[model samples]
Target chain A: MEKVMAFTGDEIAAEAMRQINPDVLAAYPITPQTETVQKFSEFVAEGRVSTDMIRVESEHSAMSACVGAAAAGARAMTATSANGLALMWEIIYIAASYRLPIVMPVVNRALSGPINIHCDHSDSMGARDSGWIQLYSENCQEVYDNLIQALPIGEDRNVLLPVMVCFDGFIISHGTEGVAVLEDKVARNFIGEFKNIHSLLDIDNPVTYGPLDLFDYYFEHKRQQVEAMEKAPEVVKKVGKQFGELTGRFYGLLEDYHLQDADLVVIAAGSTAGTVKATVDELREEGVRAGLLKIRTFRPFPQKEIIQKLSKAKAVAVMDRSASFGAIGGPIFLEVRSALFEEQKKPLVISYIYGLGGRDTGINQIKQVYHDLAKAAQSGKVSQLVNYLGVRE
Target chain B: MKLKGWKDIPWGGLILEAGNAQKYETGGWRTFRPIWHEDKCKQCLFCWIYCPDGSVIVEDKKVKGFYYEHCKGCGICAQECPFEAITMEEESKFRKDQGGRP
Candidate 1:
């Protein structure tokens, strides 16, 4: 084990980029996400890594340039947040649909109508259908770790899909936390070199990419993207286990804590999961049967792992940082409901949307959620599909 | 590993159909057909200079036109023509025979 000084979340993410040392790193900065690129630029300027760090005009061109670079068989990376990510929406879909295998870090934030530079899952959740493999981080360590793990999982021979490693904007992205820095040689060996099977601009092969496929072939391409996304969980687990062996930190599809002996559990992803874990500790100290299931990977949804982990719990409180707007409930809760609906004894799953626009989510709100879960278990009924925490009307 | 006749196939294992070269016959449509109104002709070749896709061709003192098989109908020449001598009339009769713009 290598010991280094405690580093901030942004510094750890930058070190991972330094280790990966992608051939192409293109980005236009938005708040919270700017630090990753800044440190990356410093690394490039100092000759620590030989990377083409493109200072693109907008997030659109940043992603567009990355798409071209990846198609040219270069190991590519980029970063953005909130509106920056929203601006890259079109090309993000293009990168995934074409299976370009680019890696991106999204400092997750709320999409603006009122303009917020705060933590939320809105940016990443809005891009769910874009076919990118999405991984959410619960802490600074996970942010550093997920970027290292995302490389091979994304660029796997069978997968060949783009990946987005999301950490909460301002909450995790800007918030400083202690993280153990791994050796460059170790990280490089862990991720290995990128091998592009089908690059667009390979002159020696001279194959045309992103052609007008019309209906006859477009559906098959989309179907293949779906199939590739399905293949990611196994790849993620395989890569995660390999990482654990190398670093002694185990990551899985869904990380369960104190759930084995508890009857009520709270589910959350991103930075808020840390608060939920803290809340679980308090609940257990009070002799309440409460636990937490922190989701690490959102796409490839981790349906089976979620079902198995929550099957024994009497009730579940799903905390979502983003709203699905209509129909059933919160995005995470809707997925959880669908996963549990077919089980013989389904728990009373309730959805709660909290911590929107960087509103500070303390242990009290999490404690309140656990209280609701316990009440639901006692009453044997779910009061509502979705509830907003900390909102006064 | 050297499979004959498969070298030209695109990846995702697409089988290139035969007679793909004839698809290049649309090269005839690359140039624009300028209608010369000998009465309204100021003979300014600004249309030839400003065309980005280079659809116009100027020869000698007289402006001889060609068929715009690949003309995309951008009408840049029509926009740039100083004399209003060039009109972007579609190949109505030929298009009527070939369904639409070939």
Candidate 2:
């Protein structure tokens, strides 16, 4: 059974955690992510879940406790936003290197200097190379779905690495949306029991974990992690397929919105993808061959699928919500532009840095991108390699 | 033993087999090996308790010999021994034929 519940992105994420009912959940509260931890704590207080909720001192310990629990062969999860994620930096890599299969829901907030609490891609982007599988969510619905799917995806024997399911802080995190939540029993069955192969607590086996690996072995161990990362896309596809069957919504590494006949395509991730989708629909109604390629999985980047979906377009605009300092484009734009490099019939690609520090990326701005794409296509070239949207000059 | 390729190893350097540390002989890392003076020995087993690598050999509650295959020759047993029953010796002084306790 499925029920559509009105929940903010944070609330739906907590609702998913409640249903997962993991053996351990350790998290520290930070803006945009605090409500998720608070809601899960409410579940603990109400006896809704059997999870050992560790109200930790900081995000660092929260991630460390999760690493310990997961290494001990228990299902573990945690949630955090910008600065909190920054604090979990060292352990975040350890979780993946140790292959602990810890699941984390990261609310994407702008990293601080002159600090402000709001949505951006800086938090998760900073950990882009931390060896965790990254799933970017467009709205509350994807947040709920991704959190549920992250379990089987990370815990799969072929790909036992940590996973971070990312949704834009406050944009999706605080905004209300009607989300279809799976029945508790159905979700529980899908997640199933965590099958631990090499656990610290598996006393009969008496295994060692995270030992001081030196030059003789450290490189080889790291190579194995890369192999697992290379193997993850298949597991993600399989799990997403299985999840679609359970619920009614299908998912893949990326979503192609009318790309089959599109001459101009816009690429985006997170909440901006939703805005781009709306703009695509409006343009299509007005007889424009506009489309969108929404990135669902950002890490292990799904380059092949991205290339395929974007091949037919005459011009493509890659929108990134975070900036990459001293780079040609933002993170997603860099991947898309690089992926299209070798394609025989590749479209003219351009990059747009938008929505940094929670700025509103309105539908008009998305339409303006389509107009720029059309102009670029007409001129047989993109005037600028990179562009900025929804920001004052 | 040959070093296993990355593909041949476990996913994350997980030591799957218990007591497999015995297969990895760390004794070659030694520069200074320990010499046991059996004549001066009063075997209270302080050396047995103090050996970090469990290299101290004991039999019937008596001091036996060192397991040189696993000892890194840290000399903690010599330092902890109440009496000077054990002493440190440079490995250069010993030839293969004179490499004492197994």
Highest DockQ: which candidate?
2
**Model 1, position A289: C-alpha lDDT score:** 87
Error of 2 at B14 (Å): 0.8
Where model 2 places Cα greater than 4 Å from the true spot, the runs are B91-102
Residue-by-residue lDDT tens digits, candidate 1, A135-156: 9998889988999999999999
lDDT for A358 (candidate 2): 88
Q: TM-score winner among the candidates?
A: 2
TM-score of chain B of 2: 0.88
Per-residue lDDT of candidate 2, residues B66-86 (tens digit): 998898989999999889989
True contacts kept of each: 0.00, 0.71
Cα lDDT listed for each candidate = 0.82, 0.91
Instruction: Quote the TM-score that chain A achieves in each candidate.
Output: 0.98, 0.98
The count of backbone overlaps in candidate 2 is 0
Per residue, candidate 2 scores C-alpha lDDT tens digits across A1-393 of: 899989999999999999999899999999989999899999999999999999899999999999899989889999999999999999999999989899999999999967978889999988999999999999999999999999999999999999999999999999999999888999999988897877788888788887767887889999999898899999999999999998878888988888899999998889889888889899999999999889888887998898888878899999988899999999988888889888889899999999888888899998999999999999998799888887778
TM-score (chain B only), all candidates: 0.53, 0.88
Among incorrect, acceptable, medium and high, the docking class of model 2 is medium
